[model samples]
Target: MTSADVTRPSPGRETPATAAWRPSRVVTVPPAVPPVTTGTLADLVLDWEREDPGAVCFSRRDATGAWRTAGVAEFAARAREVAAGLVAAGVRPGDRVGLVSRTRYEWTVVDAACWFAGAVSVPVYDTSSPEQVAWVLSDSGAVVCVVETAAHAAVLEDVRAQVPALRHSWVIDDGGLDELVAAGRGVGEDALRAARAGSGPGTTATIVYTSGSTGRPKGCVLTHGNFVDLAANAHAVMPDMLDEPGASTLLFIPLAHVLARFVEVLCLSVRIPLAFAPDSRELVADLQSFRPSFVLAVPRVFQKVHAAAGHKAASGGRVRAALFARAEATAVAYSRALDAGGPGARLRAQHAVFDRLVYGKLRATLGGRLTRAVSGGASLGEHLGHFFRGVGLTVFEGWGLTETAAPACVTRPGDLRIGTVGLPLPGTEVGLAEDGEVLVRGIGVFREYLNRPEETAAAFRDGWFRTGDLGSLDEVGNLSITGRAKEIVVTAAGKNVAPAPLEDRLRTHPLISQAVVVGDERPYVACLLTLDEQALAAWGQLHGRPGLDLATAAGDAAVQAELQRAVDSANTSVSRAESIRRFRVLGQDLSLENGCLTPSLKVRRSEVLRVFAADLEALYR
Candidate 1:
């Protein structure tokens, strides 16, 4: 069947918008899944263990580069042992346990063990500062924190006295897992089972903190039922991506993020083997070694991959660079034609030729086995989506929040729409407010924001959880996100503009790395641009300049001219009022360490504006 056939929802019922001012009606797409009444995530794991005791559950690479595999029974046993340790350490039912680490095997074991011990897991990003670490620990009242390395332990230790609730911290790199298991050896299996049994649908599973672009992070309270519903519906919608017996995923995204956490649980529920890459810098090598069937990453990862591939080809030689350019154009054309209906005869022939000559090599870089990929956390540019599809990798872009337990709406395998985030997952309802703000209501929605009842109440209008994202739904129920409600810039003339689409477009340029559009309360729209260092250096070499640094390049007339072309191209997609009339290239790129970008690589607009206030003002002057 075609993508249109897969995305078109059966018309049976309609959900009316709650607000009188809302012109867009609610879109309710019936779930493809049967009713899931799983009591807790632990129960789902146990069920899988009973059904397939010998099924390989996880594959982790050791320090020596050797791959270690674990089966369902083995992982469950280890989780129980870890749960016993938590219990032995005074982790009673309903206690809050904090996990601070990069994505790793131990993190998953500790998470499952928390559920097994009837404690709630609270994840803090590994890159968080000591102050942020203390704030999350104090706010969540997490009693025990498990850290990955001595460095992570040190960060927590610096603020340990400030957080009285954090009684103990364990470093996984220092044999913490073995020590915990040994400490709990006396604890019986029956006690662990009892802890798991105490959990129900409403029981709190995790407290994931928001990235806090604007202010302090707030804890989102997600329940066991929330995760179960999301995983079931997500798997139901994309069975081919998850349900096959040999389906596996190499998860490299931060588990602190709800999206990666959901993938972790979903893999367990469907008996799919899950693997973790220790460092994102090694993700390419890991993908080559593991050769996973599917992968999940943020848009930034895809963008980097696309850029790296282009740079590699261009650096090879003139002949190779020309072939790469022709291949990219052909791929975009072929994928766009398929989206329209199907490729014409000539387009199909051209695609087949590229499939052997160009696309196959590109696919090989991703291990030559990735059937599909999922991009979330931010919007994936439509150009990249189409290009990837042309190269034989279909990326299904999804949309959700930390509050939705990861995914509320996602594009299914064959239902790929390049721009839209596809249809809402089964059992979820999406509505657009009068002003085009997206509203979501479903079982996957979080119960509340921890210790913030007023804020929680404000988050919901009537029953629907206000997503604070602006978007619209097509007649067929596909969702297209415009921008965050709070991020929309209101020009001095009163015209509102969404910067995401423009920023996304500009980043696609070879030279542009990051773009932040600013025009709030100003006469016209302007932008702060950051150059892609590698791309710029390569461009400079191809031209005349060489050995160029970012500072020098930022002021160079030639560099400014190239940026102007990119800005003009981006402006073509929007109206004059919304277009960026001018831009200033910043000498330094925004980075996580610099506090200008979030750990997920999302630009912190407030922080950017604060840091570049003078540059922005000079543009208008």
Candidate 2:
């Protein structure tokens, strides 16, 4: 396709100008109920004693986390001991215990202890800012905190004295524990034991903080029933998800995310083993070494890895690139044909070519024995969405927030739908407010947002939590999220634009690694671009120019020409009004350290606009 022929959805497909918004058919939800009497995550943990008494339930990324021959029988002992310690240290049942740790063996231990003691485990994202972390501790009214590294411990030190409810902090010692121990007020081992030995089901399992990409974080108070219900429901929804008792996953995302916590509970519920990967360096290697059966990653990973492999293949002479390109095309065609559910001749012809070149490597990238790769946190671009499932890995797209106790909707194996975060999981009732806000309720609904009772009352009305997402559910009950209620931009011409779709399209260009559309009140739409480092370097080399530093490269006339071409290509499929008339290529990556992004990598819109005010003015100058 030429620069003017970028693949844009049809003109009338989803433009906000002509949107005929309809609420979700909330009544079309699937039916479900609790399977057993396991009142909570701890109750589920204890159940494993009857099933697999000697399987490894959890493992740290390091040698310390791996226990070759211990399962629930051992897990129960440790959790009970820890709960008893908490009690001995004065943590009462129902008190919130803040876990400011990375994904580790102790995370599960403390979480289970909270469940057993009828206390709440408040997970603090290891990457949260000091202010953010302090908010969680204060808001949740936590008494004890379980920290991971010294860095985390240090961040909490100054605030430790400020949070009146905080009495003690404990650190897991794989590497960064001393600082935590040093900062802690002090808790005896017997206290930990007493805390662990305390209660079950009907307890508040956790008060997980949501990733506050846009605003201040809210604490989602989930009960033991909320978690256990989801786990059992996940099993009922897809019984064969675990081939064996010890299925594994490499945990890289911050454990504070509902997705990560859900996977942890899955490990306890199904007797699967989860290996932690707290550091970025260990992520890929751990994936290969652990050979995990399942992988859950954001779209960023899928895009970057696929792009890198393509670059590598391109470097191997023209013949290799063309071969791989043709194979990909063939594979997509074959996959689509078969996906349409037919024994068609065209499908057979296409698959024959696809298998010889792409399937093997594709399978290897997914850890070889992969069953499915689950994606969430953001809406994945359409092309990448289809590309993953098209490559033979059963990619399941899901939708949820911390308030939902993990996921509310998921695309399971036999019920797969490529572009959408599929049907609502059993018991989640999805509805639409007058303003296109998606509201959800049911067993998965959180009890409340910590401390902010007024905010909590506003979010929940007549038993529904306004999701703040703008989306519509289709005939089959699958949701298609267009944008956020707050995130949508309104042009001066009164055109409502969902920036995610346009941003997704623009970022697909290798040269433009990240972008944010800006037309909220402007006459025409525009965007700010963050250049891809590798792609910029490659472009420099290809054009016979010495690669400059990021700022110099972004300002380079030649580099600007390349990005302009990319912008032109990105605009081809959209309407003139929606097209970006101009843009400024950013010199530096948007990051949290510099106050451009949140800890979770979401752009701080006001901060970015503030920092780049001159450049933004230059767009129209």
Candidate 3:
């Protein structure tokens, strides 16, 4: 059964947040996914492995300077054996299995086994506090928990006494799986039969938690129908992207996030290899090893790569730097001119010049095989987006939340808009509320937040899921996300402003890093910024302000003023009411572990409210 079989469309509604952006004429929806084959996702893995051996499905870097991987067929067989081990340990169908770990080889093995053994996967962020972990363990009613490292083991053990449902806790990579799986030796009758019995498309597959940028994280339960169809729909949009039989997707982003997990399943189902990046530090080498055709990453990765290229270009004399700058912008403009539908001989000549001089160098750093990059997780700086596209990289921005199964609208590969987040996926319905919030509905949409029926009911009126994001659709069907409804800051003068646009402007300044605007119920916009460590390092050398580290640089009067200048200059582009009048430089950088950022690297507003309560009060002082 598909999601269509599980829920019916809501009745016609009168009032709604989004008025529904009706196309001038109805466009055909994308194809609904093919029916899911029986026997679960594990079956897909086994089938691929049997076909190819050197084909590595999952690989990672070890701390001792080497890469690791499991064979295409070996990977599946291990998961089968792992499932047998779990069943012997008392795991049963409909059981909730918590994967409490960072992305690693063992994490994949255990997670895959959970699904094949007829268990529900509960993926939690690795940085979660002990108390938060306990809450998830109890809330999800998990029967088995897979701990990543010794650190995770300690955390889970602290709460195991309180969580009675947690019967079997396996510490992956702790030197135990080999012996345990051997003891189970071959598939047990009960678990093997149970695994073969299988589940329908509508059965619960996983419960993914949102990054909780708005408040405490809420769990969104997605079934086989919600996710399997999304994977198949993704294939339909760019059918040729994953055509190579031995293709691999380098898994770096945290699997706890819905986007990464969904991509993992899609790759497996489509018969592509999955090479897990060894660790965060070894990502570059991992990328080179796999030579991925497509990569899904956040904007931060592109920003860092872009910054590195700029530094390389600046190494030459003043004349060389100026020439490179002129060449780069000309290339960007030339490319844009072509994308506008018509092209000229003069534009082609300019493009050829930059392609030889600058774009070639940048492409080498990216390993040269990357065809398209899909950026999501948060709003990308518009200027940064333009910079990447200009450098000859086609970056497609997609829109969705954990609640929508991670995607509602994605810009098509052939047709892309630099500033907008592409068109709605085929087979999905996207419209704007009368008030302008994005509303989405279709087979790809999730059933509801796990157990919050009231919130679910409130979220839907006439079948549309309220996105809480504000934006308008262009004539060609691209989505432009302008701001969030809840984050609108009002000044003492009663003028309202959306921080995202202003924040984007501020980020364009080379010295400024993360800009978190604080003006809600206040007189004007104020911000807390994390200075770009690399840029600040360069600035110190140029200005003779010596500081070896970021913290020391933060206190250097000259460095502090340089950061202030970037902020002040960005403020100049906005109206007086929306501009930041006063700000403070933070000595300590905002971090995920410190409760300053979400797992996706977005600033946590409530945490900012608490940690910087004194700094915020001083703005009004």
Off by over 4 Å in 1: 1-23
Candidate 2 lDDT, 1-621, residue by residue in tens: 011121222110111333454343452244455433444566577678777777677655446644343466887777766666666567787798888877666777777767666578888878778888898998888898888877888888978776889988776764323333332235555554354454434456788777776677778777776777776667666665665444677777777778888888866776677777777656666676677888777666666766665555554555766676676666556556556775378667666656656766766765777757788777766666666556666667888777888777877677677767877677556666777788776556777787778988898655567788888766666777777878888989999887877787777665677788888788888899987776566555556665555778766898788788878877876888888888888778777676786555556776788888887777766
- The better candidate by TM-score, 1 or 3, is 1
Provide the overall lDDT of each model, using Cα atoms, as 2-decimal numbers.
Answer: 0.86, 0.70, 0.72
Candidate 3 residue-wise lDDT, 192-285, digit = tens = 6666476756677888877888766777878776676677777777665677545557778888888888778887777676767636676776
Report lDDT (Cα) of residue 388, candidate 3: 71
CA lDDT, candidate 2, residue 156: 86
User: Which of 1 and 2 is the better model by TM-score?
Assistant: 1
Number of the predicted model whose TM-score against the real structure is largest? 1
What lDDT, from 0 to 1, does candidate 3 have? Answer: 0.72
Instruction: Give candidate 2's error at residue 371 in angstroms.
Output: 3.9
Pick by TM-score: 2 or 3, better one: 3
TM per candidate comes to: 0.95, 0.87, 0.88
